[model samples]
Target: MPASRPNLRTIAEHLGLSVTTVSRALKDGPEVKPGTVAKVKAAAEQIGYQPDARGVMLRTGKTMQVCSILYSPEVGDYGDPGFLAQVESLAQGLEADRYSLVVLAQTSNKDPLEPVIRVHTQRMADAVVFSRTTSQDSRAKYCLQHDFPFVSFGRTELLTPHAFVDHDDEQAAYDAVKRLIADGHRKIGMIDPPENLTFFGYRKQGARRAMTEAGLDPESLIWMRSDVSVRAARDATTALFRTQRDATAIVCASQMTMIGALEALMELNMDTIRDGIGVVGFGGMPFRMLSKQKLAYYYQPQRHVGEVLARHLHDLMVGVPAQELQTLLPYRRIDDLAAFREGEDF
Candidate 1:
């Protein structure tokens, strides 16, 4: 006969605990002590015990799955090393706790609400996580109305508080502009994220505020809304220099955008250091290979962002209050930008 698979009873017997106690400990019931919970989990792992998820769902209304709302790749996130790192870390964190992550991909940004709604209506996941929030996100409202657990990777304009872990994009933008201005680049311009994103305005506001604080005309701070692609940024940069010859600097939304801007300058036969132009943008360590002119750039801890988002969603799943989970982390700045040189890893 085939060997029997280890179940709750197998774990309970191995730990000398009652089946009821073992189950409660595995579920992390409030009544169970943390020590007991840890013991039960360890015993289960050792015994190779697996719960029938269908039965658990029927009894506890828990899906053992979380959902992530994925946006279009063309909207700037395509081939983003930082973004890929963030998602990878987030998945690893959840998998560590036996909770599976289900990514719901969207075809367009025109309807950001559809996937969230589908997850809710179909009981596809216990909680959801999403990014690129707008000023007033209807998806947040829907999740709020249903009391479904969720953690947004970005903030919204909603008056009602919710769980979120967001980077301080405004502060990062402000700092980037201040650095560029300090470098003596007076005529500053930007290629920004899509206008619909709330952070786009936050970044714009920060840039304007920085200029204002420096006694510069905020209104004259040139702005270009791009589709978050290298080609779009290159085209935008070309146009910017064509019209505004006095422009001395460019702040981009992402490393890809900055790369395009650099390409534009290259095509124009203008060197960043030679032409007295400054470049500032946001990205991860991967950008070290592409950096130039020792310019300042903001770096987000993508792995940390993912891990925190995963933890927050798990907290929400375990009945933690949403308001208490809100976090705003400032992006770190690399004061000098230099590309990898001479036989270094690309």
Candidate 2:
């Protein structure tokens, strides 16, 4: 061995003091004399002595590490910025609780639970947080079965008493559709995500509810499902326009979808549709600045939602009740008129 790293024991031996006394002095314990505390501090700094994190964790059973798993989508899919913002906000919130966040990415993997399982089995993190939930999320199910401390960014239909933070996608869709109806757009269309995702179901439900409330035939309204990609949305929009020639309004699931819709409209020489087309998009409004089309959209408080999820995970790890661990954040609607006047779209 080259040279051994210094430890509290070595310091105690060099200072000719008891281990307890040296430990107390190092921590500035009240029991240790002031002069001895100063001397211990100076000695520690001189020797480059640092507390062993593993030892501390072994002693207290707390790693002070919280993990979140991110599933990188297939090649060419435009990831959601709102989801990234949530991760950032969660990190900030966890920092306040003196916990470090460990983000693990599962890229090019079909199994969503792979990274989570690896983190848990390897003892790399104390608690786990997951996002992009499905109707039956395997990650949530695994955590629940193991009785591990965990939280989700979205809710699942597993019937397990686990904590989660989610936005009201149904309400968001409802509000967007209602706004289109208010603009006197009777033949409304929708460009939503695939039906398997839980949020997509909620969003579609809200759209149907709004159409029914407005005395419009829900079945008659045009709908197209797209992957989380602009290309897919564009293709869906093109298909919708080619098929539903009477579509006067469209509600998109995200900003990327809106952009794709705009692209398709442009390609089809339907650019003038913006003047009369009532289009509503979900997600943050920042992307509006990048596009020429003035469209109504929803402002998802992703950062706030992330922070809430982090705090809820912290609480759960510290024994907070499961019932109290759930929270649903609300989204704001931005109509076409308001979307134009807000100086900064972001």
Q: Rate the local accuracy (lDDT) of all candidates.
A: 0.83, 0.78
Cα error of candidate 2 at position 263, Å = 2.0
- Per-residue CA lDDT of model 1 for 268-322, tens digit only, reads 8887777788888787544654534546668776888899998897787777888
lDDT for model 2, please: 0.78
Q: Which residue pairs clash in candidate 1?
A: none
Q: Distance from true position, residue 265, model 2, in Å?
A: 1.8
Task: Give lDDT tens digits, candidate 2, residues 191-229.
Answer: 877677788888888988998998888887677878766
**RMSD to true structure for each model, in Å:** 3.3, 4.7
The top-ranked prediction according to TM-score is 1
lDDT of 1 at 139: 90
